[model samples]
Target: MATITSAGAGSGIDLESVISASVAAKKTQLQQPITTKKTNTQITLTGVGQLKSAISTFNTTLAKLSTAGAFNKRAINITQDSDDPILKISSNTDASNGQYNVTVNKLATTSKVEGTFASSTSSLITEDGTLTITAGDGNEFTVDVKKGDTLQQIRKRINNASDNFGLTANIVNTSDGKAKLVIDSGVTGAGNDLKISGSTTELKMFEADTSSATPVTGSSMSRTQQSTNAEIDVDGNILTSDTNTFKDKVQGLDITVLRVSDKDSDGNLKSNKVDITTDKSAIKTLVQEFVSAYNTLIDKSTELGKRNTIVGGESQDDGGALAGDSMPRSIRTLMANTVMEPNSEMTGINSIFQLGIKMDNDGKLSVDTDKFDDALDDNYEQVVALFSGENGVAGKLQTSLKEYTKTGGLISQRQDQLNSDLRDLSSREATAADQLEKYEANLRAQYGSLDTLLAQMQSSASYLSLLSTS
Candidate 1:
C-alpha cells in the first residue's frame, strides 16, 4: 500500500466551515433581516390599501352628493299660457296672391317677435267657367249654359264627360234628404278658389242676386283654431304658455331644448344657444358639500391618529403598531398645508385656515362651525369663488392625490423595489439550503473513510508484533 500522508488523505477544507460560510454568504446576499419585517410590512400595506380604497370611495360619494340633482330636488313644470293662440286659414288665388305672413310675439313681458309665411295656396282654386266639355264620342257639346247652373245637371255633365273634364261628380245626400252635387278639389286649394270665365253669362254667378245664392266675396272668412292649456310650476308660482318662450318658462335660468331630430357628426344633439345663471340654492348646496367633505376628512384623520390600549398596557402608537405609522400623519399634513399654501393658480383657496379650519398638535383637524356659517352668510360669493371653478381646493387636492398614487409614483416605486428584494432573498435562501445539504453529505463520506482506514491499520500492526515475538 502507498504511504497515505495527511495531505494525501483527503481535502483540508473544513466541511462545517464551508457550510457555515455558504450560509452566511446566502444570508448577506439575501438580506435575511427582511424576513422579520415581512409580517409588519404586510400589516401596514393592508391597512394603507384599505385606507386608500376608503378615500377613493369618499371622493366618489362626495362628487355624487355635490351634483345638481342633490341641490335641486324640485321638478320643473310647464304650462300653456292661453287657449286660442294658433290660427289656421285656407285661401284661393294665384301663386303670388296666395301667400300670407304670420307673426308671433311675446304679448305681456318682452316684445320679442318671430315670423313665418305660407309658401303658396294657389291650389285652392276648384273650378273655371270655360269648360270645353266633350261627349263620350269626342264631340264638343254646344249646350247653352246659363250663369246659375243647377247643382244636379252640373254633376251629370261632369260625370258623363269624366275623360275630358277629369272631374269626379257625386250627389251627396244632406241630413234633410236634399241632394247636392259636391265638387271636391283634387288639389288642396283648388276648390277654394272657384272662378267663372270665357262666358258673359257666367259673370252673374259672382254676385248673389238671389238670397239662396252663395256670393264670391263673402264666401270665406278667417277662423281661429285654439290650443289647449299647458301649465307647469316655476318655483312656487304656476307658469302658463300657449306658445311659451323657453326663457320665460324657466324664469331666471336659460335652458336650451336640443332637438334630437337634428344630430351632429358625433350623433349628439346640437346645443341650442342659451345662457344660464346659477341660483342661490345651488351655491348653498355646493358650499355645504365642501364643508361636509372637509369635516369627514378631518374626522377620519383624527380617528387614524388616536392611540389605543391593548389589555392593561397603553400603546404609544396610533391605531396599532402593525397598522399605524407615518402615512396618516403625512396625509393630514399634506391636506392642511395644501389648504394653507398660497398659489397663483388657486387665489381664492389660498388659506382654508382663514376659513376657520385649524389643526391640533396631534395632527388632527377641526372646523369652527359658527365662524364658517357666518362666513357663508356674510359673503356667499366669496365661498363660491374659493371652490367652484378650475382653480379650486378640491380640484388641486384631486390632482395631487392622483399623481401620488399613480403607477409611477414614489410610493409605487418603493413598493416595487421592496417586492424585488423579497423575491431575490427567497431565491438565495433556497440556493444556500441546497448547497448546505450537498456539503454535509460530502463531509460525512470523507470522515467515515478515514475512520475505516485507521481501524484496518491498528489490526495489521497487532498481528505483525505477535508474529515477531513468536
Candidate 2:
C-alpha cells in the first residue's frame, strides 16, 4: 500500500502521527505472542539437538564395550631369566592365556653372490644372451643382456626384469677402479638361495650357479652366503619357517625371531617363556569411556529441566526455553531410571553397580577402581555377560536412544513440528502487517475529510460576523 506524503497537510491537524501510533499499538498486540513463541521454539530446538547428539555418542561408546571380543582381549609378555627376549611377540583377541618355552635353534639367512669386474665402466657381457636367475623357494627368472653391456647396465637389466625373482643386483665400485656385481636374495629361507646360470660366453666369467647346491669355482663370481631357514624349538616341538616371523604356530600368536637365544656357561640352551593373559586394562578403558560419555549426556539432559528464579522479567532460567517440555524431561528420566534398575536375562551381576560402576548423588557415574578391578578378577566371565548379554546395560541404553535418535523418531518429529510452527508464524506476520497498513490508511482518510469540513464551516461563520457588525 502507498502512503500519502501529505497526509493531513491541507488541514494542518497532524493526523499522520496519530495514525502511525495507533497502527503500532495494534501491531504489538497481534505480533508479540508469535514472536515470543518462535524465539522459545528456536531455543528448544537447539537444546534438543545437543541432547540427541550427546546420547548418540554415548550409545556408540556403549556399543563398543558391549561386545564379547572387547572383554576377551589378551596381552603377551615374552621374558627370559637374565637376558633380553630374543623374539618379538604379539597376540590377537582369540589368543588363549598360556606359557610357552621357546628355544631358537637357527635364524633364517639370505643367499648372496659377488662377481668381480675389471672395472664398473668395463664391459661385463661380451655376447648378447639371456641370464637365468633363481631366488627364494626355487623361483626362477631371466634377463637378456646385450653384447658389450657395462657392469651398471647388466645390473639394471637384472634389477628391472619383469619376471624378476626376489633378487636384487647392486654394482659396488672398488677403490682399485674395479667393480663387483653382488646379487642377493630378497627373501630368507632354505630353498630361496640365489642361483645364476646359462649366460653368454663373455658373461660366463661371472657365472656362479648353485641350482643343485654345488659350488662353482674358477670363475670371477663366487657364492658368499648360503640360504637357510629359521628353526625354533617350542616346548620340544620343532618348527621351521622360511621367514623368522611365525604365525598361528601357537594359536593366534605371531612370533618374530630377532636373534638366537644365548647359551649359558654350562652350554645349556636358554629359552624365552612367553606368558599371555587377558588384558584387563583394555576392558577398564572401555568402561571408563562409556561412563564419561554417559555422564555427559546425563548432564546436558538434566540442564534442560533446570530453572532459575525470575522476578517479573524475561525468565532468568536457561531452561525456560524447554520448560514444561515432555520429550526432554522423559528422556532424562528414562536414562537415569534404566541404568539404575536391573533387567531380566542378565543374571547375578545384572546391574552396573555389581560391576563396581557407581552413581553419585548428583547423577554422575564413577567407577570404584579397586572394587571394579576386584570384580573383574573374581567374576571375569560374569562381568562380560553382564554388559554384552541381551538384557545388558548397553542393550537397554541402545533401545532408549533408538526411540529418539532413529529415523523419523521423536527428535525428528519435534524438528518437523518446530519448522511448521515457524512457517505458520511467518504467514500470520505477513497478514498482520497488511491489516495494520490498511487500518492506518482508513483512519487517515476519515480524519482528513473531517478537517476539511470543519475549516469550511469556520470560514463561513467569520464572514457572517463581519457583515452583521458593519
The candidate scoring highest on lDDT is 2
Give the Cα error of residue 344 in candidate 1, in Å: 5.4
Tens-place lDDT digits, model 1, residues 260-351 = 12346997522222222233454445555655665576566556545565656756444643244566667667767665665565445446
Against the reference, the lDDT scores of all candidates come to: 0.43, 0.78
Query: What is the alpha-carbon lDDT of model 2 when measured against the actual structure?
Result: 0.78
| Global Cα RMSD, each model | 20.1, 4.7
Please state the error at residue 265 of candidate 1 in Å. 54
Which ranges in model 2 have alpha carbons more than 4 Å from their true place?
Answer: 6-8, 80-85, 108-113, 121-169, 183-185, 188-229, 266-268, 311-314, 341-343, 389-391, 430-470
Over 4 Å off in model 1, which ranges?
1-34, 37-48, 58-329, 342-350, 439-470
